[model samples]
Target: MANDPTHQFLVNKIVPIEIGGIDFSFTNASLFMVASAAVASGFLYLTTSQRGIIPSRMQSVSEMSYEFIASMLREGAGSSGMKFFPMVFSLFMFILTANLLGMMPYFFTVTSQIIVTFALALFVIGTVVLYGFYKHGFGFLKLFVPHGVPGALLPLVVTIEIISFLSRPISLSVRLFANMLAGHITLKVFAGFVASLGALGALGVGGAILPLIMTVALTGLEFLVAFLQAYVFAVLTCMYLNDAIHPGSH
Candidate 1:
C-alpha cells in the first residue's frame, strides 16, 4: 500500500549477484550504509583538512566532535580507553550521520534494521570479550563476580550477572533499532494522515492542518533522537570497554 508505514524500510536489491550459494547482491541497505560512512568520513576530512591557528566553523565542529568523544572516553573508561578512540569515534559518526540522513524523505535508515544494529552491538561486545580475555587471561571472569556477595547468594548473583552480561548485545541493538524504527514509522503514519486528509478537497484540508502540525513537530523531535541514540550507543560502548580494562573492579 502507498500509505504503509513499513514500506519505507523495504530492502530492494540494486545489483543482483550471487557467488556460489551466497547472495552477494548490493542492496538499498548496503548503499545507505556506504553513504552514511562516506558522508561521515567526508565531513570530518573536509572540515579538518586545512591546519588553522584560529579554527573555522567547520574546523570547530570537527574539533568539538573529537573532544566530545575524548571526554566521554576519559570519563567512561579513563585514559587507557584512548587506545580505542578511532573505533569508537567512527561508530559514533556513522550512527549519528545515518540517523540524521534518514530524516530526509525517502532516505533509507539503516539503523532501523535490527540486523544492522545488532551486528554493530555484537562488534562492540566481541571487542570487549576478546580484548578482556587477551589482556586479563582468566582474570576477566572477575567481571561476573561482585565483591562482598554472601557465599550462599554468590552463585545466584553470579548467574544473574552472567545473564545480564550476555544480554548486552540484544539490549544495545534493540534500543537503537526500536527507537529509529518506531520514530520513522510514526512519522510516516502522521505524514500519510496529512496527505490522506488533504486529498478530500476543502473540508479535508482543514482537518489535515492538525496532522500536518503534528508531522512538523515530530520531525524536530526525531532529529534530537537521532543524535541522542548515537550518543547513548557510544557511551555504552565506552562503559563496556571500561569493564574490559578493569575487569576486577566490580
Candidate 2:
C-alpha cells in the first residue's frame, strides 16, 4: 500500500463539517488551494513590501512574473484586454502557484481534480459569455460565424464553431487534469519500482539504479510541465477573452 500510485490523491477531510445534511468538510484539496493562494500572495506582496534602490531577489522574481503575465495577456487579448489584467493575473498566479506547490513532497496537486479544473474552465467560459453579450450584445453570436466562408459551407462551419466553443471547458479541464494525473501516477510508479527493486538483492539494486535515474529525470520534467500547463491554461483564457472582446472579427 505504501507504493499505491493513486494513494497520494486521497482526500481525507481535515475538518469535518455538516450543514443542511450536506457534507461541507474541509479536505486536503481545500488546504492546498488555500496554501497556494497564501504562497502566491506572499510572493507578490511580501516580496515588494520593501522598496530598495536596487531590487532584491524576491522583488526581481515578483517583477519578472508580473511582466511575463502582463506581456502574455497583452499579446493574447490586445491592448483593450488590459482592462481584465487583474483577473487574468490572479488566475495565472493561482494556477502557477498551485502547480509548483504540487511538486513539493507530500503536497496536493490541486489542478489534478476534474472538479477543480472544470470549475476554473467554466468560470472562464462564463466570464467570456457574460462579458461578450454585455459588451457586444447579440453581436457575440458572430463568433460562431467566420468571415469569408463560402455561402454553401457557412452553416456547417458555424455549427462546427459552436461545438468547438461549447467544448472549451471540457477540453480545458481534461487537458490539465489528465496531464497532472498521468504525470504524477507515472512518477509514483517509477519511484515505487526504485524502492522495490533496491530491496531485492545485489542484482535488483543494480536494476534499481535505472528507475532511480528515471525518477530524478521525471521529477525535473514534471516541474517543467507544471509551469507549462499553467502558462497554457492562462494563454487559452486570454484567447477566450479576446474572442469575447472581438466576437465578430473571427
Model 1: per-residue Cα lDDT over 221-248, one tens digit each: 9999999999999999999999999998
Clashing pairs in 1: none
What would the TM-scores of all predictions be?
0.98, 0.98
Clashing pairs in 2: none
Candidate 1: regions farther than 4 A off: none
lDDT top scorer: 1
Query: How high a TM-score does candidate 2 get?
Result: 0.98
Please give the TM-score that candidate 1 achieves against the real structure. Answer: 0.98
lDDT tens digits by residue: candidate 2, 147-209: 999999999999999999999999998998898989999999999999999999999999999
Best by TM-score: 1
Candidate 2, lDDT over the whole model: 0.93
